[model samples]
Target: MIRFENIDLAYQGNNVFSDFSLEIAQGEKVVLLGKSGLGKSSLFSLILGFVQPQNGKVFFNENRVDERIVWNVRQKVAFIDQEISIGDYSVSEWLTFVSGIKANHSLSFGGKRLKELMDFFELSRDILNKDISDLSGGEKQRVAIIVSVLLERDVFLLDEVTSALDENLKKKTAEFFVERKDWTVVSISHDPVWLKNPWVKVFDLEKKTWK
Candidate 1:
């Protein structure tokens, strides 16, 4: 379970969101929707503990979201963003490094498991040896998605993850999300395919007053 209680946040005195509240039960798939600047991504960042609200609180599994347990929460959640990890290695090396992270390492997905995931995501075997810079936006997005899926985290925080994908790829990823029997999904998306999905619990940010 997760809760955002009357949260208020701002940047330089400008309101990001105010008096915002929502709850997500385990295994539920939710969508946060509104105009672009209404702090949809900030909501995602808050849940991931990357950003703190100026007031109010965020809770994960009924515990307050704080530094002490943020890492623990992160270990159980996979976040996929459009721009992530433009790095100094080949595509394969990126996977190797991330899988070695403490969170992923504990998941026990070694090279063989990683290869299986890459195959499932439809990544070209050649990408494994290619420089990260050589990958197109779509390829990088797929790689990032594979990384998250391999983590085996039941919860996903996705932000326009399909922005660079074609219709086929979008549906493929959607299928992946749907098949996860225990997934708790919260995504910030404008893609028509995702926005209208009934599996999502919808929240609209436009009705509230900015702080």
Candidate 2:
């Protein structure tokens, strides 16, 4: 449901992408694998309208992603950046605030749902009461993941989300997303655990093609 056509992106005369094109169908799971500076994260920015290409267009579903419909597009996509930060608010407060947002108003954000996701992710229930600043890197990562899942958005753009987790959690997290047949997951990760799932397609950004 995401397509890029002949995209040309650059920063301060440094070109990152040139004539780049890719199409991700609905419910497809793709992983971006490459060294740094390959524009892997830029692809996500293009889809979210955070950045625009100088030449070519980005499309989500059937519509072109432009200023007119960017907000609408963002409402349906969940982007978890490499360095996730929600603010200093307590976990419960953050969830409450997010649930009250206009786009997420319809999604259920209750104690049971939070508890279940926490358990599945091996997070303690007491973490809901802890401030974001108090949580470790791994905890913050898992919490960010939980928030994304709770938003119930079918399209996910995850950037190195498993970087802080232990091996077991990394495997669990990868399996969880890959097993969800209804979700369109595009992730950028150096962790090889994601490659263990035969269904996860790998795109080599440096090569500008799928591996």
Candidate 3:
């Protein structure tokens, strides 16, 4: 659950959000649709404490998010960025590093589950040994998603996550998240596959309307 109340935000003399407000209930699936520069991704930044609103508040699960609890909020939410940038580490090394983080220490990355997810995402297990920098864009995206899944976070912030996937893979990815009844998902995407899901509500950032 996330809520933004009357937010006003700007950067370098340019306004991004003005008196913007939104509330996402638990287990809700929302897709933010709009042209670029509409502050779609900035919403996630506010939720994650990457940026703070000059005028309003951001709340997560009934608790106001601030510096004191930002880490906790991040631990509970999985954010998969459009550009997967985890340096030059190998896939396996990246997985190990993510699982090794203090916030993720309690969540075990089971080899069996990892392989299963990789297979479901149409990725080869052998790719684990490949350098992350060498993987194709689609491969990188799937790998980022798999890592998020392995973390078992109930809330997801997906930013153009299927941007590089093929048509089939895009559908597969959309269906996989749409079927999760207990997960809260807020995504930014232009992919029609996501919008086709009846369970997903589309929020037009530019118009400040929902469809």
In terms of lDDT, the best-performing candidate is 3
lDDT against the true structure, each candidate: 0.80, 0.91, 0.93
Tens digit per residue, CA lDDT, model 1, 1-211? 8889999999788899788888888987776678888898888789888889999999998889899888888887889975866768887777678878865666654577778877777786888899888888888888888878878888899888888888988877876786676898887776766766666566677874311
Model 3 worst lDDT run, 10 consecutive residues: 106-115
- With candidate 1 superimposed using the best TM-score fit, by how many Å does residue 35's alpha carbon deviate from the native? 1.8
TM-score of 3: 0.98
How does model 3 fare in lDDT?
0.93
lDDT of 3 by residue, 1-211 (tens): 8999999999887899999999999999999999999999899999999999999999999899999889899999999997888898999999899999988898878678988898899998789899999999999999999999999999999999999999999999999998999999999998899998899999989899898
lDDT of 3 at 205: 90
Instruction: Give all TM-scores, in the order shown.
Output: 0.91, 0.97, 0.98
lDDT of 2 by residue, 1-211 (tens): 9999999999889999989999999999999998888889999999999999999999999899999878998999988999977778998899899999998999988768878999999998889899998899999999999999999899999999999999999999999999999999999997888876798999888877788
Highest TM-score model number: 3
Error of 2 at 100 (Å): 1.3
Estimate the TM-score for candidate 1: 0.91
All predictions: root-mean-square deviation over Cα?
2.7, 0.9, 0.7
Off by over 4 Å in 1: 110-112, 208-211
